[model samples]
Target chain A: MQQTRTVELGTGLFVFLGVVALFFLTTQTTGFSGFMGGDAYRVTARFDNIGGLTTRAPVTMAGVTIGRVEAIEFDPERLNARVTMRIDGRYDQIPDDSEASILTAGLLGGQYIGLGAGGSFDNLRDGDEIYLTQSAIVLENLISRFLFQQSQEDQDD
Target chain B: MSVLRELGESFVSFLRILGDMALFLLRLVMYTPRGLLRFRLVVHQVHNTGALSLVIIMISGLFVGMVLALQGFDLLARFNSEDALGTAAALALIKELGPVVTALLFAGRAGTALASEIGLMKATEQLSAMEMMAVDPMRRVVLPRFLGGVIAMPLLVAIFTAIGIFGAWLVGVVMMGVDAGSFWSQMQANVSGDEIFEGVFKSVVFGIAASLIAVYEGYRAWPTAEGVGRATTRTVVLTAVSVLILDYMITAALL
Candidate 1:
């Protein structure tokens, strides 16, 4: 009986440790803070090209993340890409005229939306769309353009 | 003609074993509810399988994580993006290595023990003795151990992953000159809930497969010393191959 009790206690401890580890993985390491629906408000932006922007990518202001991209869809009516972002409720003072731009993190890192605050007195609210938006810069387009300009310069010479 | 006949016979035997395993699994599932009633026995088996195997799991996780950091740093330094080490290491550990490695270790540690123990009991006629007294050996013996393994597996994987990340942090931040802030923040920013779910889901599937194979092999052993030895060996070999194959299938399906 004593041996059985000891075994039971040890098993209980092991299970408890396992649960703690799981909690840490989900909450701290992965940064999953449960459902985001209630604590955040949605805003929309339109860009000419999204260029590998994925849902759940960070939405940052001055390099500090304040929200995440909730959805990306093709705007067939406008012939552009529509992006929906969920900004944290605490950051409710974003100006109505703020510029939203898709930017890459490092030279080859993933892309995220970077928001530049505008000076307008009006604050953006949920369901509001930012009209001033910049699209993602495609590397291939930049390279081809640079090559074309260099060839033109050589021809002139 | 003789070689073709031999190949056909082997194929038929393979199908026969597969069908037998399926029937055994069905019987095991049917007895599971009755086995739950004997919860104390299940807990004891959990202690035997889970707690007893904790040290090896932790040590192995630490070493694996350390190696990943060392290799990852060297590879990423060429690109001048060593700050992404945390994200790289954490994602690999959480998405792939954690569940797969832990399952392999579980097969080697607990699976063999369960197989050999049950095999020996059959060898000595202990299981038959219980049957003579009207106790269903399936419920009294097999189901508790299986349930214990299934319950303990996710927990073991979770612990292994967490320790692995810590080991990476120890090497990348403390020993190496990588920036500590980026090490953690990069992981938090990039590692999502879906990847963690994938790891947990794989662990559960692996747990069921490993446990079921171990008990099935032991229950159907030949009731002799040589038979028991062979059963234990088969349990390890079968569990390892199936876990890896299942890992690939699950990853492909999830992706």
Candidate 2:
């Protein structure tokens, strides 16, 4: 009788668990719509060194993600990496002469593109290239430069 | 001349230690997953290490979350970035601190216990008797604890991380006066499912490594109480070292 009761209880427990697992598995996704919102216009910006420029990396204007990098490609002639970005439609008035610099999110962190909006009335459109682009400040390069300068100073001393 | 000879001796000793460790690891990996006996042993070990450590982890997690929110509130308010508290807390807690610290704590608490238990079993000749009885001690004993630790370790880490975020919310809303809605909403906005999966993946691997080290040391203990004691001490030390090393390697790979 006890064994029969235990078996029944176990069956009930398994059913309960199956229900809970289903709920958790279904609930896990929560839809991926907000992630790919499209009130943004896609544009291209090229850099000599995009160092760690990941897909979906932020494109910033005044440190806000005006858009995100949609894709990255290499240009052998200009010796640069081109970042294609999707920027918010609201920021369409940004001048064509605006500077785009590849910036670090924080010290020793991910790379992002920063747009310095110019006052020129001529604004950019899709497929128009951002001309004034700055490459990422390579950290190792900077450290080596600093060390070389210091050694030069030491030699003079 | 003496220094060179001493260096030579140490190098040979190191190589011998490495060979032993490699052989043990190879044998353990090969011998695992034989049948039900092996499976049960793994589950039992995981229950001991993981289920046992849940209370301590939860309490620690809860308080830490609250304190972080409070501390972060003051700093963020100075820059008017208080709205970002939840995002910051979730990213920092889930991505980095959650798994690493929990693993360290678990290593100290349960890893020590595993080592001591196995060491005692070895010192008493009970392990040898099981071997003589054709019980296959690896399947009957070691594999169970190793597998159990691996399974339980990740689950425990997840529990700790969840409690921590909840704790952070409690402190953020009640103490620091951040709106609860905003906190949760920001968390939803920033903390990706991928990030959470990555953290869990790391913890699972950490669990397997930690359990193997602790259990292996204990299973091979010398036939003395002192030897058993030595094994426990080594387990804690080795587990902690290995956890830190693995954490660095994973972060580098992810980056």
Candidate 3:
């Protein structure tokens, strides 16, 4: 009986430890905490090319992440990529005229949306679209353009 | 003609075994409520499987994490983007390595133990003795062991992942001098709830597979020493193959 009790006690401790680890993974390691606790507002932007921008990528202002890209959809009417962003409620003062651009993190890192603040009094509200948007820079396009410019320069020389 | 007949007979035997396993699983499920009522028995098995396996799981997790950090930092540093080490290591551990490795270890450690123990009981006629005494061995013995493995598996996976992340942090930030703030912050910013759910879901599925294979092999072992040994070996092999196949299927479905 005593041995059984000891075994049971050990099992209880093991189980408790496992639960704590699970809680840590969910709350700290993942974005589950932010998803559950924060209130956020949605805004839309359109780009000709989003590059490798994925859902759940960070939306940053001045290098600080302020929200997340909730969804990316194709605008059939405009023939562009429409991105929906969910900004944290605390950052509600983003100007209506701000520019949204898809930017890469470092050379090989994932793509994210960077919002540049505009000098307007009006703040962006839910469902409002940011009109000034820059598409992601395609590497192949840049390389080809560079080569084309080089050829022109050689011809002129 | 003899060789062709042998091949056909083997195939038929494989089908029969699969059918038998399915029925055994159904019976285990039916007796689960009764097994729950004997919760103490289940607890004992949990102690056997979970607590006993903790040291090995933790050590393996730590070493795996440390190795990931070392490899990740080396690769990321060449690009001058070592700050992404935390995100890379955490994603690899959480999404793939943690659950899969834990299930593999659990099968090797606990699965073989369950199979051999049950096989020995059959060899000694203890299971038959219980049957003659009017106690259902399925409910009394097998269900508790199966439930224990199923319950203990996810917990072990969780612990393994947590320990692995800590090991990565130790190697990345402490020893390698990676920026601590970026390491954690980047991981937090990048990893989503859905990815974590995928890991937990995989662990649960693997737990069921590992435990089921162990108990089924043990319960149906031929009542002899060589039979018990073969059953134990088969438990490990089958569980490993099923876990890997299931991991691929689950990842494909989720992704």
Q: Identify the leading candidate in terms of DockQ.
A: 1
Q: Indicate whether candidate 2 or candidate 3 has the larger DockQ.
A: 3
Task: State the weakest 10-residue window (summed lDDT) of model 3 chain A.
Answer: A30-39
Lowest summed lDDT across 10 adjacent residues in model 1 chain A is found at A30-39
Per-residue CA lDDT of model 3 for B1-255, tens digit only, reads 999999999999999998999899899898898789988999999999999999999999999999999999999999898999999999999989999999999999999999999999989999999999999888888999999999999999999999999999999999999999999988887788888899999999999899999999999999999999999999999999999999999999999
Better of 1 and 2 by DockQ: 1
lDDT of 2 by residue, A131-153 (tens): 89988888899999999999999
Q: For model 1, how many clashes? A: 0
Candidate 2 lDDT at B138 equals 73
For candidate 1, what's the RMSD?
1.7
Tell me how far the alpha carbon of residue A66 in candidate 2 is from the true structure, in angstroms, after superposition.
13
Chain A only TM-scores, each candidate in turn: 0.95, 0.74, 0.94
| Candidate 3: residue A112 Cα off by (Å) | 1.0
Model 2 alpha-carbon miss at residue A54, Å: 4.9
Q: After superposition, how far is residue B236 of candidate 1 from its true place, in Å?
A: 1.0
**What would the per-residue lDDT of candidate 1 be over residues B94-148, giving only the tens digit for each residue?**
9899999999999999999999999999999999999999998888898898999
Candidate 1 structure lDDT: 0.93
Colliding pairs, model 1 = none
Docking class of 3: medium
